[model samples]
Target: MSELFDRHQAVLPKWLAIYYSDPLEITHGEGRYVWGADGRRYLDFFGGILTTMTAHALPEVTKAIAEQAGKILHTSTVYLSRPMVELAEQVAELSGIPDARVFFTPSGTEANDAALLLATAYRGSNQILAMRNSYHGRSFSAVGITGNKGWAPTSLSPLKTLYVHGGMRSRGPFAHLPDDEFIAACVADLEDVLGQTRPGVAALIAEPVQGIGGFTSPPDGLYAAFREVLDRHGILWIADEVQTGWGRTGDHFWGWQAHAENGPPDLMTFAKGIGNGMSIGGVVARAEIMNCLDSNSISTFGGSPVTMAAGLANVAYLLENDLQGNARQVGGRLIERLRSGCAGLPGVREVRGRGLMIGIELVKPGTDEADPEGAAAVLEAAREGGLLIGKGGGHNTSALRVTPPLSLTQEEADEGAEILLRALGGG
Candidate 1:
């Protein structure tokens, strides 16, 4: 480790994981590339874990933030703010929830916490149903609902959370079953879990595509089937869209739309990519659910003028340019290329994803056993080839996460795939 890495370790918590055997300090970024402190430019495929929604250093977003900062940075959530209102209006319209209300927070962790608060309060229960191998956030309440053990440091929580099966379809009990039978089995599992729980179950929260759990997901309409059961008990469905939102999935604007059979989610939490790198997260809920809390609450730095301005500009750019269509077109090509390139690689187990949020799982050669070390080796090789990537999975970070900015072009996609293939030692 360099002096900077050594200093980072001295100051930061050990649990805050850093990538690679050696760490690089990224100083600046433009478009699809970022320069390290050593001044080497590397293609940014992960986009700061998909926080950079449109592009890096986008002129429109930068100008909006600068202009807003010049006027007023923040006025808290108490008094009215124009930029806040504008962004809120846009988000509410796109939320797909009827009579939707938006409350901004600083990060996805806080957004999930707020959703939990609202659901528990509205439904009058402290019990929550969460999907196994799922990850929400790092906060106390968020960790409580999170089912991924690697992310959850402590078991203590205010709510009673029960883990449900069928979140990750690849390595679960129903992985071998057909799509219809898999959904049925998962629904049956959910019914059994519900039967074991008390009547105080407030809501069931899920990630349409499990982000930190290696981008794994169950079949389409699985949640809709689960929704059928939750409806009988009045359990609200909360879609955690921290990673799956903003049309990154290609086919849908929101991840929950994959299960559109039961209609929109009762509550949805969004963060990460909305501000295009700024701290902006929020919960969208129907009027009655949002207005359930009787007392006043506020996020001290949430929805500030600067972040809201950035969000407005970023969202506008995303829509006007039709980046979602770009994701569908370019992402489809990239995944196809990857699938073709890594066909017989020894460690490569599966290549799966929708749109730009793709994952390539690695196993111990021909066995089903996870190979985290192999995944790490591939990461190191990709870095040497000047391509940046991320890794995550339920089994010790055993998969590569390839979530570039939604504005990723075909040429860039091909370049990244070539580098990744070389790193995997594929010919």
Candidate 2:
């Protein structure tokens, strides 16, 4: 074994290694490529789980951070900061919710926690409705509401929550129902839960495009229907855009906007791409929601000047360079290529998702069910072939998630697709 590996095995906590067991050691990254300790460069298709929107070590973002670092770094929320205000205003404008109030946090989990707190205060309800296969965050309350079983171990007793079915097609418990029937069943489930549970139902949280859950996109008209149900139940709608936000979807500046024709969410949480890997996350709520949390809510490092500067620069870069447009164009091309390239490949289940957030599901030759080993093999093969991708789904089953940076070039997308195709063939 290498000396570094021996040292890591000796000194690093066993629990930490168990969480991230990958053996590869990456030393540096630039653009869509990361260099390993062995000096091999690999094309990164995951884009840091969709966080590196502007690409690795983007010059403008780095410059902004450096400039801000030299000037001043931290400023408590008790006092106003220029960068914070600027970034808040820019985010509000970009979201098309001009009067939206922004609350920054250091992580997406914090942002979701904040949003949940605000929602509870606003509606005076303890009940929250979330979709199955959804992942909000790992925090206590967020995890409680998250529908994934993996998070169940974290919570002592999952809070008062109701699970609604979402995605392209509703099945399992939702098998007998048609599309409209499934939606109605979901709404009825929420209403029934609200009626049976405690009086106040705080919020109905959902991802416009479910991230960790195989990149599942909600069925058409589902958002609007869910919004109507929430309104009828006097609950707020929280859009968990932590993974889908910041122009990753290409059609809109915010993920919720893609479903605006349905109904805009009352509270939207953003992270991942907002700071372009600078550890910034936030919640944007309607002014009414902000009003409810005035006295009780607070954060020590929520909106630091340096974090705001990085976020501001990232947003500015996205706008100035029209990276969202690039995401749309390139994402379309990539999706088309994948669909065409693997049209006849056995065990290729489906290609789903929007813009740059794509998922290629792999299954047995004759069925649409998952094949986890096949998926792992594909990922490993792709990595060996100098490309890095990510796996998703509840069991980490065969779903290759392609969330490359918005700046990914057409050639790069084509190469990634080719590599993925070759990996699938090996499987």
Candidate 3:
């Protein structure tokens, strides 16, 4: 172990310093727990930023990957692979997007980038409308739609993107308006922007439930109204489901499904939970929009048989066991427990989120501004108590993002909540 650590230390890249690493190196993971180099175990609540929905080292998914890897790995999309076709068919069927065409990519960033490019190509537009505080991805085109400035440094030129504040804070471009008025203003603002930059507006992209943007859920009727406006303007609505899709939200397989009654988007992008930690992503488009693309776009490693097999197995597990229902049940219990546990803690401001994708917002004692120190204390206490967690939101503000795997037991949820409550007490 010492020799292996020495080798890794010698070759590890300096760019990785941006991430905080624990001294106890992780050696293996199973279900919702990860074991360290010292063989100590810790309960994982973040689930690899909500990627490992079915859990780690899941038997069926592993077996599928191993079996497919032994038979075949890569075949360009020019030719067909059974796993790829099957996975695409399954995704389409589950999403209720009939005969929907799927395009594979190596990451969610690529998926979002492809969606943006396709929107531009289909509409011949160069401008995109995205929500403030939303995170799409890091690639150039995806970065253009991402509202976080921290993700803007990689772009060579300023992004041709328009931004609107979602319903959360009260002082932004769309503030000082009632919910109905705010939605109408947003739609009008978008139309005004498009008129000024006429014929160049490609698409309006947003997360159904904003993830990196502090887990903010928009007010009722917002998405439906936005869909109508986009349709009127001949613009496409792209649902960036990278972080919120694949049953993370509990009630729906896709985050947008939670809003399906409102209206569906033209294109949807997925990653994270679909592959269960395997690097795979895909775009599901309405037949008409997909057919317009002329087949010029292709990826070399997009839908390799091995990754597709893993995705198929993950989806199978989700369906066969009714994991989405489990997410709802377990997530409801966890949310209620969290809200009740931290209801009156000092420096704790709000508890919000749907299903298991919960967030506990920490604020300074007297100000609405974030309480980073209080958040750090809570995180430290939770870590010391043998639970692994993560933080998110702009300004590195206080949000303890809790998204445990679907397989996490109720007992584990109780323990996790108890630890979090104790951590809040420390703050």
- Name the candidate that leads on lDDT: 1
Overall local distance difference test of candidate 3: 0.79
Better of 1 and 3 by lDDT: 1
User: What's the candidate order when arranged by decreasing TM-score?
Assistant: 1, 2, 3
Better of 1 and 2 by lDDT: 1
Range of the 10 consecutive residues with the lowest summed lDDT in candidate 2: 14-23
The whole-model lDDT of each prediction reads 0.93, 0.80, 0.79
| Residue 324, model 3, lDDT | 78
User: Model 3: what TM-score?
Assistant: 0.92
Q: Model 2 residue 332 lDDT?
A: 87
Error of 1 at 25 (Å): 0.6
List where candidate 2 sits over 4 angstroms from the true fold: 1-22, 155-158, 168-185, 294-297
Candidate 1 lDDT trough over 10 residues, lowest sum: 165-174
**Best candidate, TM-score-wise?**
1
Residue-wise C-alpha lDDT for candidate 1, range 44-139, written one tens digit per residue = 999999899899999999999999899987799888889999999999999899999999999999999999999999999999999999999999
Residue pairs in clash, model 1: none
TM-score attained by model 1: 0.99
